[model samples]
Target chain A: MIVYLLCLLLFCVGLYCILRKRNIIKIIVGVIIAEYAVNLLFILVAYRRGGRAPLHSPDAVIENMVDALPQALVLTSIVISLASTALLIAIAMRIYQKYRTFDITKIRELRG
Target chain B: MNYFAGMIPFFVVLALGGAFLVSLAGRRLKIFPDIAGLLTTFSLLLLSVLAVIAVSGGGLLVYSIGAWRPPVGINFVLDGLAAFMLVTVNLIAFLVSLYAVNYMERYTDKWKFYTLFLLMLGGMNGVIITGDMFNLFVYLEIASIASYALVAFGTEKHELEAAFKYAVMSTVGSLFILMGIVFLYSYTSTLNMAHMALVLAQRGTSNILLMVSILFIMGFGLKAALVPFHAWLPDAHPSAPAPISAMLSGVLIKSLGVYALCRVFYNVIGINPALSSVFLVLGTLSMLIGVFLAIGQWDLKRLLAYHSISQIGYVILGLGLGTPLGIVGGLFHLFNHSVFKSLLFLNSGSVEYATGTRDLNKMGGLIKKMPVTGRTNLVASMSIAGIPPFNGFWSKLIIIIAAVQAQEFFYAFWAVLASILTLASFMKVTKYCYFGRLKEKLKGVKEVPVCMKVSMSLLAIICILGGLLILPRGESLFLGKAGYSLLKGTSYGNEVFEEVNK
Candidate 1:
């Protein structure tokens, strides 16, 4: 129960960083943090108190195995996050080249 | 035609294969990308038409990946709604690719654009066809990420800024969606949507389901650019190249945001009075706020982008009423909006191509110079503003009538007000950009090339013929099937399961 709360806390921290940060790189990092927190929460959901490694052996009776699906899913989620982060970083680099600043406040060419 | 069932997976296969083959051979063979893109999207369009026929015959069509049965393996489900969206997505994709063939000449690295464009098409097809929750998320990311790159394709100052903001907000939305999926999986212990729906029906609802619903509303609403979460669209849509703006505005938001939201809430979770009310308020807010914000914009593309928001609100309003007529009106509007909106964006692209500017204030008497573009823009503008005999007028009328029928009088009034304001704003566009005195700077501008002309004319012709889609006979083949599926709601699970057994 406490572990789940901790994961929620971590997610909030990432959301705060994303919402409150003015630096472009910091916002990107905040997205990364939020992504990791969600991935972590997914892993925790699959965790069992005293489960085995979800491996099968003819010699041993299978019992109390942890859910393996979320683990596999987390790997895919991580790859997706990696791709988005790389793209965001590339965009940030180009924005810096154009506007010469990492502060999002300074990059205001588009508006209503 | 038993083999018709087998063609379901080919939508994704053809698109992904085409994307890969284009990127691989495009560098060496410059013309290959164009041919491949045209062929793949055109084939996908034909397949989607066949899908509509297949579904109209009755019963769901389920394709289990790796021959794995549902609740244990991922499957692809093609029903009325999926076929509807597939047709909409692929139709726009084919036309946009055709437009891009000529319009893209101004930009360097045309092969790269085709590669990303095809990939995004594949992603959207995947999202529409997939039967599992996690599968939807994966495809949604695939589509969203490709669009992010495409929006920044110019790699200029404003493009990068828009793409960055779009990427960040979209990623955050995806995370919220992922979180919602995680919650659903944890609650139901199943990933297949049909199976999950069955489980929820058997187990009954809890607070966890409510939380998941809230998360989805936030996530999908942001993707749809509904009132409160619509900050990125005006910037991103105008910043992307025109054909891309057409695709993004035309199909991406519908497939990723509205379609997903409807599928999850109505099909998986099952809509109730409370959920329906939430949709009502949100839809109404988006309708009024979006139009009010749009009327003052002078940038042509940006104005059109803001109107995209307002039009989407009509779709949501119709669907949220949760009546058969409402669903029919909403689905019909969805198709009509795609036609006219893409046409409008393509027209804007042609103007920019000729005059090298997108400001409506700077364009004048363009009809005297570029007659085809001007005439097509006039058709699209009339359609979007709900003028008689145009497709937009029919759909908006249906939505308002359905709203009044449902006794949602206030919403009906707002819909009418938005329609009037839409006309006023579009009239401003016509007066300033097409009918006024010829600008000195734009005097030497020429008509756009053949391919752009052909594409714009095709869409404009559709805009004119769009109202015919709602005729009694035409309704059964098109909007009726899509609306029926949404009206079926959670019974969709039973339909899929029954089809899987066959």
Candidate 2:
């Protein structure tokens, strides 16, 4: 229960960073943080107390092993995050080039 | 045919393959990207039509990846709803590709454009067809990422800013969605949608379930641009290239946002009265607020983008009513919106391609110079405004009738009110952009190329003929089946399991 709340708190922190921060790179960091928090929650949901990796050996019992499926899923999610983060950085670099600043308020060319 | 059912996976393979194929071969041949894009999207459209035929009798076609059965492996589903969505998506995709053949010539790297376009198309098809929760997230990201890149394809200042804002907001939405999926998985102990639906049914509702539902609504609502969550759409939709604008406003939001939202809430989450009412309020808000904001915009594409939000509100309102007629109306409007919206965007693209301006004040009496684009715009504008004998009118009529029957008289009044406002705004568009007087500087404008004219005319004719789908005979083959499956509700679990057992 405590772990879940902590995970959610971290997620909210990331959300705050995204929403309240003015720097483009800081917002990117915020997105990464929130994403990692969610990924951590996925792992926590599938975790087992005192569990080891779910490796197989002959005549070994399967007890005390964490669920492996979410780990695999986390791998995929991480790769997706990597792609998005890279794209965000590339866009940020280009934004900096065009606007000459990392502040989002200045990047206000396209508005209602 | 069973063969067509097997062709489900082929849609994704062909699109993804064609994207890379174009990228590799387009380095040498300038025209190769156009040919590849047309061929690939045409085949995808053909497959989607065949898909509709395959599921005509109202059945589920399950394609398990690597021959693994459901509840264990990810599967691609071709049900009545999926089939209906496929035809809508791929049809617009093919037309947009055809339109892009001419419109995209203005850009420097045409091949990269085709590659991203097909990539996004493949992602949409995957989103529609996938039966696993996590796979849906993956595909949604793929489509969203490709779209972000496409929005910034020009790499200009406004384009880059719009792309950044869109990417950040959408990625956050994806995170919310992922969090929802994690909660569902933890509660149900399964990732397969059918199996999870069964688990949710057995377990009944809880605080955890309620939390997940909120997560999903926020996540998918943001994607669909539901009023409060709609900051990114106006900027992003108009910033992309024209054909891309057509694709974005046409089918992207429906397939990625609305389609997924309906699938999750109605089918997997087991929607009840509370959820239905939430959809109602949100739908109504989006309808009124979207058009109200749109009425004041001077940019042509920006107005169309906001109208996309308003039009989607009607679809959501219809679906939220949850009656069979309402469902049918909603689904039918979904199809009609795709057709006419794509045509409208393409018409805007044609105007831009010729005149190099999307400002409504600058264009006038273009009908005299560009007869095809002007006439097509008139058709699309009428359809969107819900004028008679066109496609939008029939669906709007059904939704209004459904609202009255459901005793939602207030919403019905709002619907009609929104419709009139829609007509007024579109009349403004027609008066300003195409009518009035031929401008002094615009006298040199000409009709678009053969491919673009052909595609726009095709969509316009469909706009005229689309009303015929509501005829008693044709509804069963298309809209009825799609709506019936949704009306089935949680029996959806039994339906999928029953199909897999066979």
The candidates' DockQ values read: 0.89, 0.92
User: Model 2, B121-178: lDDT tens per residue?
Assistant: 9999999999999999999999999999999999999899999999999999999999
How close to the true structure is residue B499 of candidate 1, measured as C-alpha lDDT?
Answer: 83
Q: Give the lowest summed-lDDT range of ten residues in model 1 chain B.
A: B1-10
Q: Model 1: per-residue lDDT, tens digit, A1-112?
A: 9999899899999999999999999999899999999999999999998998988989999879999999999999999999999999999999888888999988998999
Q: List where candidate 2 sits over 4 angstroms from the true fold.
A: A56-58
Task: Name the lDDT value of residue A67 in candidate 1.
Answer: 98
Q: Indicate the worst ten consecutive residues by lDDT in candidate 2 chain B.
A: B1-10
Clashing pairs in 2: none
Per residue, candidate 1 scores C-alpha lDDT tens digits across B295-408 of 999999999999999999999999999999998999999999999999999999999999999998898999999999999999999999999999999999999999999999
